[model samples]
Target: MTTAKTFSATSVQASNAATPYFSQPIIITSLEQNIWQQLEQEIVRSLQRLHCSRLQDSTLLLLHKIITNLVKTMHRHAFQRAIEDDLNLDISDKDSIFTELLQNELSMHGDRNIRKFCRANNFQITLIFPEEKDTLIQIEYPTSCNNSAYLDNKLAKAIGFILVKQTHDPSSSYSRAKVVKNTAIQSFRPEQAGYSQLLTQTEELDKAQAIFSQLNHGIVVFSSVGDILAISPAILTLLKLETALPSVHTFTNIIPDHFYNDVLWGLALESQEGLFENYRTRIRLPHNNNLSILFNISGYRHSDTTIHTIWQVVSLDHKATDTLAEGSILNEARVHNITRNYIPQLVEEKAREVVRLGGHTLPNEECQLAILFCDIAGFTTYVENNEQEESVIHTLNLILGKITKAVKKHGGIIDKFMGDCVMALFKEPHKSVLAALEIHKHSYDFNSLRMRASRDLLLLRIGIHWGKVIIGNVGAAGRMDWTTIGDVVNTASRLEKNCYPGAILVSEELYAMVTHAHATDISFSQPFYLKLKGKRNEQMARYVQTEDEPFLHDTVAHSARQHLKTD
Candidate 1:
């Protein structure tokens, strides 16, 4: 398994190319960093957007709730970026808002203006937006946080709370642009005078120079208008630029003109939250074949109106060449890139294949979602009694692998794994039911294989429910976990516990959703009302039986099954 490569903060020496890449992980602010001072000054001057939304109080309330929920979820390993309308925001701008709202926790009940709402005994708010330079004065709602990456459930929930109607139609949700791989770039057009002034500022220049020296990867900074500000020595080495860079390091001068559109696409940040693929291209070399580079582009506000677009460049993965052959090797900049399907819960290798064939990451959404929860029956007892530690682990992994396959086969995205349990999400209700049916049917065969091996046969319990769930990045500053969570998730988990061994139990809500779908070949038991754990009221549930297994059309077996379709 490839691990994240770690670079020294202030070193020129490159680590072994075979070693994994590890960028600095960002963390949420705690009390120690004097969090208040930083937060008090971090709110951007774009308070007008919230007030102008026509639902000022509700919007502020909604923003506060999201910021609160996200902060509470942030641990040491998760990172998040905040975006508004497709532009990335400095999600780290939590300090200013936190300082103001920490004590004023408001009651979000009625329709009232923000000023009045802020005056409420316990009202507080926070907002997340993409990084951009605007001269909007410092008039912000009291609550906000810097954010990025997955936590779809939170985002969807937040959006649902504020927008009575969606901004985009369902069909327009998926991106139409050629989704590039291993590359992410954001575009910006800063005012010319401000841009030139920023380039000349001693303080800005010093900050840029200081940051460039410590980075171990190639980075090329430019503007949407094609003006290049600075180029790192690492990138200089990759391009084999002799001597020093000329006075005008424009995009046309540095990047091949043909690839400029790719850079523009990278900057054209999609409004949806997703792990985009990096753009791939080759560069001319003085004495060697063109070397390919993986690029991820993003922009940050250099000043009030100047946007500094940063192009992060890394060499494509290759066999570990031992020696740096002058122009042939890009020493420190060598990196092993992973597919943008960064969510491990999702069967990414296949997802990447889907992406290659025009299927992209599901946009940040609050859509009707079907959530499936599956777990091994009696997993705890089995773990303790199993004598061979390695054997047990291996067997468990094999079982989980099979489950993962079954879920993917029937078009389900594995959300996450918890011990012996797995969570999968689907956009289609019928597909979700089909996936569950296939898994339950496949379980019998799977257990039989284990029995032949003289190992314990696994009994699976699965629960599925349908409801609206948010899908996006939910983590800290540098870490992200792409998954879904909401009442539907909780209901599914509850129903899973009520499941009998070797059976797929489903919630009443789920059963209702799929009942009308004549497309499935399954049987459902009558609603079984039971008092679920930690619940004040009893809920209705049912068991799903696979009367006949449906063939996964997307699978290779679909072609061979043409003859068997009549059965």
Candidate 2:
């Protein structure tokens, strides 16, 4: 039950006193003073990023005084970074800059920029002290107020100012202070050097960002350390987040604990091999609906040993499609080319079935089949330590070629290639087991050759199970994949994930079929119970492997006979 650790703003509590009054000033330690200074700098940076006009000298002084007073009070429990709703401030002076800013109601030119800034940003300031832990002293430029008469009352509470209203009286003696225009503000017509170029660049950047954000149907970018760089609006919406952005800064906070390991594994593969694509699975959301998503990762490496990963998450239920409208030549050509290019790569059985349907959609059908999954163990580590990219890729392809040939030789259909793993389907459970044994033998020979060559040994872990599954095309209109879907697929994958290197794990159902047939050449370990992920009950499975030279020839001949029967 491992979980992600959450990061929070640093805060310190007074160790000596349980309660201290504002009137009784406490000596501020250097460390506490440093914390306040850092918080002040953070506030300044936030405001600057928002393009707010610089605070006037009087306002700056007031802000410093407030922070200084808060630190001396020894009543501060925590300092929180600003969130969307409010910005807290403490005010004691009636003639302060905030009062002047709020008092401008009748004059058209009075504090208009400041008012726009506050309203646009939804800025509010709050302060909490020892006596009033629940009560907050707030200063905000209100957008609307219900009671005008209560606004005139200057009643002070335990801490300080609560809320100030805009005064419209013409005869009032409160003089409006001079507004400080933002220095960076400029007219549409540029007048300074590089101003036009800068504005053009800024506009282009803004448009690019807007396009990128909209394109993020479920895309996310994060650093190697799991710090989230960006997440798409679609993902935020899918997650049903209350805020416009994610509250947590790390990717692990948003990912389910059960799926974290899979994500980490993908990241490892991508980091070492540069890409991990088309990994499909169904994730149960908090709303209890299972959403089918295809995860793809692309890694960018920098010279300083930093890797940033971009994850493209496509929803299988609502996959993006390009629709052909009347008189749209580009759309028609694009769709035609994509379909022509993709159809040939599909499994032969599925491709022929699709063609036989004569442009009609194939309905999903359930049938019993044996699912097999296999992957190279220690592949990511070997790739990371080995700098020769070409050699790594060549070795990977060689191993996959061997596995693919074994699967085809045992009457199996290659379903898909998931980075280091390959999935296949077979009509017979015994054939699937035979395929797994063949793959183990191929890996053993490959490892022996690599060992003699002084190269890293790559071992394979395989899993097989026989169960009923639905086979059909899944995706949006104009874009779909012929694939198998059911619990059997997941269970087979889990078996592969849980198995040790150079071993083949099979579920009781599949193992029973093999043993009942009395396959004398095959050898299996003792039956074991596995508590697989996403399963309510433990599963019974056994490791199936091949024996030494005495049984090898007979097993290969048996596999050949099965393959010929299927042919």
Candidate 3:
């Protein structure tokens, strides 16, 4: 295209009538892109020509020293008029983006001449108005793709400031044009800009949305302002929500409480600080509150140049879900109050706190509980022999702490720690039996290590019973203890008091219940009836034993670490 100073055209009527078109965002669909593009382009040309005409009078003798800015900026994608900015001289796409983008993007110095480099179009547009010395405007348009001379603005302006790319690949032959006109009142209909050369990028955005909807992956696009602009259909399907989405989308409305922190981190940056990458998180479903999915988070600049965060959810197999008891209140209660991840002592503490906060007493209720009472065999005599107080405390804490961990590991909660003794409760008889086996095995290892260290070897006497107990918080609200108080507790304590060292004794009722257990893992002595303290009739009980340690894995979950003392 010809530079403003050298280029000339025949005088033609330049109308300023704004009848059909004023500067407004046109609401045309992408299918009607041609008309939209023409209107916007004509508006930009008319406005810029008016600016250049103003400069012609203002810079009559000022020459090159009087450079004027391009006053009207428009963004056209293929054949679609996308957006407009009459104040800044930036092009809307990558082809003619401000050359300053190559430098530190934060440093915007505009002392240099206008320049553009289109890598794909294989051309450059340079507008240089040298100092008062040159006093001339020079524009060069070069296409090395073809062996033709680079067209100066004098010839390129006549050709409507457009160049066709000569590429072997048809798809790569996309054409681009930019016109900075200074006509002497000559205005004819301009050549076809990019109507047939390439489709408007709105079509590409439409295709992207279509593909996003069809894919199984969920997509959440957040605007730079953190409001959700669009969401893929898959997000609704994956989150188990209705296919129809709400009008006002936001992270606060969609993301669950557990995962809000992750999205907050993404939005905090807003593509200005840095690129946001995959931040894995759990996403709870809106419609099905019970279900949730693991999502991977990321962010990018959309076609509108707005930052958007995407949450790509990974659908897991049924086996990866929380627990088998889908809607059971009991199971959910256990998760909140008595999860195995905590110490056995802490589980009941948290459970009681939950109940106390509700402003209701834990009413004593009769329920079947697997009560386990265990004590260090000959612990009193061992203490008499070893009178070093600090040594005793250290040894007791080391061993007792390990035993307490085993109780929690087997899904039982510690009811009390009775100096060298432990009383625990379990919902299933099998778990109490497993805990006894674990304690028995641990005792053997403890004695072995003690023997090697020349210390008195210790033994474990454990008793397990399955029967009804009144379980609840005992004492007033200010000071209370969560415990079981019934005949079942006494029977279990008596069983432990009667048991011999290095053995586990179980009541006949516990043995009968465990007989139906899946692979009981415990062998029992022949059933025997014993007349015990306070028992009107004979009490049936068995001496429980395990031949092997049962080669169990260390942790129940994926995250537990192998502790030196507990493992």
Candidate models: Cα lDDT each: 0.49, 0.53, 0.53
Residue 225 error for model 2, in Å? 64
Question: Which residue runs does candidate 3 get wrong by more than 4 Å?
Answer: 1-359, 518-520, 548-567
Tens digits of per-residue lDDT, candidate 2, 451-517, equal 9988777878888988867676578876777788889999999988777666777899998878877
Kindly state the number of residue pairs that clash in model 1.
Answer: 66
Error of 2 at 547 (Å): 2.2
lDDT of 1 by residue, 225-291 (tens): 5566566556566555543665235223545664455444332333233112344444444334444
Q: Which is the leading candidate under TM-score?
A: 1
Q: Where is model 1 more than 4 Å wrong at Cα?
A: 1-342, 345-364, 452-454, 547-567
Q: Give the Cα error of residue 184 in candidate 2, in Å.
A: 96
What does candidate 1 score in Cα RMSD to the true structure? 22.2
Identify the runs in model 2 with alpha carbons over 4 angstroms from their true place.
1-348, 357-359, 548-567
Candidates, ranked, lDDT: 2, 3, 1
In model 3, pairs of residues that clash are 1-153, 1-157, 2-153, 12-185
